[model samples]
Target: MGYLFGPVLSRRLGLSMGVDLLKYKTCNLDCVYCELGRTACLTSCRDRFVPRQKVIREIELRRAEPFDHLTFAGSGEPTLSLDLGEIVSRAKELVNSPVAVITNSTLLSSPSVRKEVSAADVVLPSLDAVSEKAFQSINRPASGLLAADMIEGLKEFRKEYSGEIWLEVMLVKGINDEEAEEIARAAESTEPDRIQLNTVVRTPAEPVEPLSEEEMRRMLEIFPGAELIPDWDWCVPDRIRDRLMELLMARPGTLEEISCHLKIDGSDAIKYCKIMENDGLISRRLHGGKLYFHAIDES
Candidate 1:
């Protein structure tokens, strides 16, 4: 529960358990519509964000749980962690579930990073733009990244990675939505196993609106094999819920903050918090019109 989040039902991967490789807000891009809010450390450097041992240990411990996929995801970017490949290799040896990494594909240009992700069962990489200007406006990636280089990296990864590769395109109303043809062209270049069309379902760090369902369907048509995945699931395993509550109690968080940090939905986080409060496992405090949760014993 400390580094790992739920056995929550995911539309893409059923009963996915998450592993946070980097600290909160450590990422390469400060995306406009990120569910996790602003990026605090928006650098492209690959370093040890979380100690390697801790991540491996958590994966080992969580291996006993019932999860369909063991995902490398969290509040920040997973690919930014220098030891990502080793973590994926170690995790594969430790668990029987399919291993996955949800990456923004900014670091895929590096051969080492591509090699690391190749060990996983599936790699879900994001390609929201075809042109440099659109990429800059949509992802708002760190200073060093070039959309062309990132696309090249994805193309390279497809050749080296034998595992399934799913390309994720997050559609923001006025931004990337207008460039559906370009986006589809870019996706075709990568030749991913699946093209996943997604939209902003949670509150974003910046004020960005979600695209309409009709627009999403139109976007899907552009990519022949692509599918639209609307965010809606909320179920969490009882044991995983208990573990998540324990972690949240140790560190207080707002509903938005909790969902962002945990990579779960806001309503789901709120529901779990209420259940924990009713069970006398945790308590909440109202600060500046927003509720913050903490352990009852912390008082």
Candidate 2:
């Protein structure tokens, strides 16, 4: 699994098989909460960091569970790989699973990058800050980038791109937190399908404080369609749709929590949840501003 790692369970994409196109930490921004330590190769220039052929070959050789997605999400911004579009296209052609790319919105400013990444079925791009001050404090993006410009690019991406865009907002205490209103406004401007509210729960690169769960819940005011990614449980099993229903039978939980609990692929999890929801095996309710699904007979 040199280039491809895990049909790793994800809180978002579930049983996501990852593709690492660039060397570790080769990115344009040094986000304050990056789990992979610091950006070892911080440059904006794009090249064949790992030969596209190698990545494609690895994915072709991969043997695992029915992955929910073939993800281009490994160390650093995946869009920085020059052949990202080709890889995305080839992955789609090679596998039946939906392809996804998790990227920071910095490179979405480029039409070429957006065009390439648009090939994915889902694109999760980060928009952690709106104003320059907060952007610098949180993401510590490359020297030449601007937050305002990045927002514009994200809006533009929504225009031409047809895939589901799950915009990620990495909230940190005091930095982006103080400016939630502004960040929410920026998130609204992008018009993403889902606005994923995440925080620094994992060990951070910097000694930054994470936002309390209550603080994150308050974010619902501005982001009406937002959902919080919970502390997901790790368990991977086959027959994901059935497994998800079985888990819900024990206790009601949010969609992402189900993904985390079962280590199910996010795409496949959502698909199964929908089927279950529609078939009346499960039902949903709003509790504490979070959507919870439960067995229909549960009290």
Candidate 3:
């Protein structure tokens, strides 16, 4: 499962199976808020970094889970894989689940890259900055990757591609958040199906903190209709995934507490808890050696 991970649950895409294309940290940008830390490859070249047939073989092995989407994302930007189109096409042929790809929008400038990714059912590209200065500071993209070109690529992509484009904007307090108006302008120009605003929630490569919920609310004022993405932990759901979310929406719990709250056996409680944990739906913390499970903010 080197290239494949999870039939994880996400608020945006339910029961997703993640497919990583690029090797760990092989990216076009060394983003300040990257959860996976700094880029080791920091490349713009498109090649078969990993064997295409091998990845397809991996997918064929894990076909039982009814994943909502076969998401092309990994330790880095998916567009880095030159064989992305073939991968997307083959995955669709192998599985009934719709294919999706989460790209950083860095390689959209390449016609081949854009054409390759269009095979996906949905494309989620990001725009954290419309201005070059902001782009350099926040994303630190590869040399010669202009902000203007990336923006234009997205705009062109909007015209050519028919799939749903949900543009993501990741905010850091003093970095990109201060330029919300510019980000909105980019969003308007791109005209995606919807805009999703997000902030860092986990340990980052750089020293930065996620914005407060209140701050995110203020940001909504600028983006107008954009939705704020909830910070989700990996949840391992049991047989009843919906019930886990419903119960956890009220409050977080330990397996014992969740068992009591849902009136289930303690043995069954731990089993469900472990499932939800693996699914990335809920996060756990240890207190006095007891593991407590808590659902992340789904709003």
| Poorest lDDT segment (10 consecutive residues) of candidate 2 | 229-238
Per-residue alpha-carbon lDDT of candidate 1 for residues 126-201, written as tens digits (9 for 90 to 100):
9888778888888888897998999999999999988999899988988888888888898888989999889988
RMSD (Å) per prediction: 9.7, 9.3, 8.3
Clashing pairs in 2: 13-266, 14-265, 14-266, 15-265, 235-262
User: How are the candidates ranked when ordered by TM-score, highest leading?
Assistant: 3, 2, 1
Which regions of candidate 1 deviate over 4 angstroms? 232-299
Two-way TM-score contest, 1 vs 3, winner: 3
TM of each candidate vs. truth: 0.77, 0.79, 0.79
The candidate 3 region of ten consecutive residues with least summed lDDT is 230-239
Model 3, TM vs. native: 0.79
Q: How close is candidate 2 to the true structure, as a TM-score?
A: 0.79
Q: In order, what lDDT does every prediction score?
A: 0.82, 0.83, 0.82
Clash counts per candidate, in order, are 0, 5, 14
Model 3 lDDT at residue 67: 60
